[model samples]
Target: MRYISTRGKAPALGFEDVLLTGLATDGGLYVPESLPHFSLEEIRSWRGLSYSELAFKVMYPFVEDAVPADDFRSMLDDTYQVFAHDAVAPLVQLDTNEWVMELFRGPTLAFKDFALQLLGRLLDYVLEKRNQHVVIMGATSGDTGSAAIEGCRKCKHVDIFILHPHERVSEVQRRQMTTVTGDNIHNIAIRGNFDDCQRMVKASFGDQSFLGGKTQLAAVNSINWARIMAQIVYYFHASLALGGPDRSMAFSVPTGNFGDIFAGYLARQMGLPISQLVIATNRNDILHRFLSGNRYEQHQLEHTISPSMDIMVSSNFERLLFDLLGRNGDEVRSLLEEAQSGPVSIEDYRWKHMRKLFDSAAIDDDTTCAMIREIFEHNEYLLDPHTAIGVKAARLCRRDKAVPMITLGTAHPAKFPDAVARSGVVSQPSLPKHLSDLFEREERFTVLDHDLKTVQQFMAEHWKHA
Candidate 1:
């Protein structure tokens, strides 16, 4: 399978090259030139397979030519074996028609582990074969930083640097990344918001002369094709578990970077019979504004209790635009450029087309907490703040009550005790046994100003290869 950049200027690359190259040289995210489709019979045939087995069947087509079948299957076996649950992504019934898919069973209790664990293995397989070393530069609002560090910490070849907003993320989220000590892992706290850290990572990837041309950068963010590919598997997993192809499944994803819901869209393209995808957001609701009308503009970033969804810019939205605008790179570029002056809308026809299958809602902190307390009182099930937003959105925007609606439980509740307390719960959520000692562990990190040169210089000084 070949991957093409959203801007349509960079050379199309195979899966291996796309895995190694984060942002395309043209400052665009890479998407597949053509998607692999599965017939109903084909999707149904694998309904009984395990999560790892289903992942191999779903993802093999993308990397078939780049990685050998045996080696790839072995890597899949290793990637999923680390998850804490027997069923990696399991479903729990919250209501007769509503369910929650738990996605925090991995080593780092968040949804990102499904992708990053596999990404680390894939990087090791490819980099070791080429006998080369690389660096990972990623920005996370909360979960991605910890998951990326956990995923890449063991790899001998890549030195991974993750930047998160200082004093912005929750205490549990910060410790998850800062407490993991490794020669290859470095965490930086930028004195700014998530957008600033993301901008610095993009700038460094766009021009890597800061590394003295000695190394290429890998991406662990949703911008990487591997992360997206790994995410698509879970959508298929959820559907197959819920009896797919016979009945339609709908998803409500608490979105920040747009990667998770975009995976559901790809699942529909791959014939999983997804009925609806709800773009659930917190107060920082750029996606809701865009889908509600068509304006894609930035606003002031608010530090909400659901800090993971506190992003002004949704980067993965570009990939969806590439497909929605008929893959017209020039048109995509023009719309983005036009947004620099003020708000910009897509062609009316395009916006209408996207609205056909997608629904959106922006939930505030009070509503998020209310939903959390209400669910706990009704069903005795506590939801993390982000998942509470998703559950609220599902109830508000559900198109069909006949179809099963699944809200993605993105992270463990222990990650955000403040939200739990505000929900009026008497008992706080406790960390897992493995992380029972998280509070006592010594932390390590560097605080840096939100400047490109300072961030890059710090990376250059600390990078093992440099």
Candidate 2:
């Protein structure tokens, strides 16, 4: 399938080029020119397939032109085999008509592994085919960095550099990134918030002359179309597991960059019968304000217990804007320019159209903790702060209680011990057997200022050309 830039100016590209060239030349995100849809019979036909089988069925069309069918199938099988759960993404009923899809049962213990692991394999395949080498530069709020490193560290033709806010991410989150030992992998702690880290990465991507004109740059962030493609599978996986195509489901997604939930939107576009999609957020609630009040406003960034959702600008929102404006890239550019100075709102009709498919809520830390405690006390189930926000939002914003509500459980509780403790839970979660020695592992990382030039220089000095 061909991919087009959301910003309109960039040339349409096939999946291979889009995978290698992350941010489009026109400063836009890449999307499939036309989505491949399925019939109910086709959806029904995929019921009993394994997670790998289901993934292949959902994602093969996007990559079929670029990757051989056998190679794609092998990558899907290998990528999910690493997940701790046999179901890959398992659904647990939390209450009557409410359920949680456990998506953190992978190497990084976050939903990002669902995409990044498969991304690494795809990178390896493409780079090797063309005998090319690339550097992966990504910014993470908390989970994406470690997951990117764990995902891409094994790629023979790639150098990986990930930046996260210094002392802002949890100790577990930091260690998970820094503890990995590889000559090609580097972790950077920027002396700023998640937004600063992200800004530096975007600046670097915009101009990579800092890489000395020799090495190509790629992204492991959700900006990559492949990551979004990988994530869409599990939504279908959950629906099929719970009697979908015949029955409708709603999803409450704990999102920061908006990539995870955008995958759910794509799932709905691809013939899954989704009743609603809830935009669940912590204190950083720009998305909530936009959905509920038609105001997309900028405010000072705040650190929260759910550090991953602490992002100020939701980058993937642009893709949705492009869609809402009838794929008019010029209008998206204009709206973004308006956003640069202050708050921005879409046309009234577009705003109304959004409300039909989405509902939203902004849960504060106190409420997040309360939900965590409430679920643990009543159901004996522990939810990390992010997922707690999702459950809370799902309950608050759900329109039809009859339709099954599935909140995307974004991370393993072990990753956020501080939040767990604050929830008054005496039972601390233990790391999985594979990560039992995580705390004992020595970490390697560099602390850098929030300057793009300095970061690019450091990346240049560190990595030898592959």
lDDT of every model, 2 decimals: 0.93, 0.93
Give me the displacement of residue 446 in model 1, in angstroms.
Answer: 0.4
lDDT, candidate 1, 1-466, per-residue tens: 8899998889999998999998999889999888899999999999889998999999999999889999999999998999999899999999987999999999989999999999999999999999999999999999999999988899989999999999999999999999998888999999999999999999999999999989988999999999999999988888888888889999999999999999999989988899899999999999999999888989999999999999988999989999999998887778777776789888899999999889999999999999999999999888999999999999999998999999999999999999999989746799999999999999999999999999999999999977
* lDDT of the structure predicted as candidate 2: 0.93
Per-residue lDDT of 1-93 in model 2, one digit per residue for the tens?
A: 899989899999999999999999888899999999999999999999999999999999999999999999999899999999898899999
Superposed by TM-score, candidate 1 places the C-alpha of residue 211 at a distance from the truth, in angstroms, of 0.4
TM-score of 1: 0.99
What alpha-carbon RMSD in Å does predicted model 2 have with respect to the real structure? 0.9
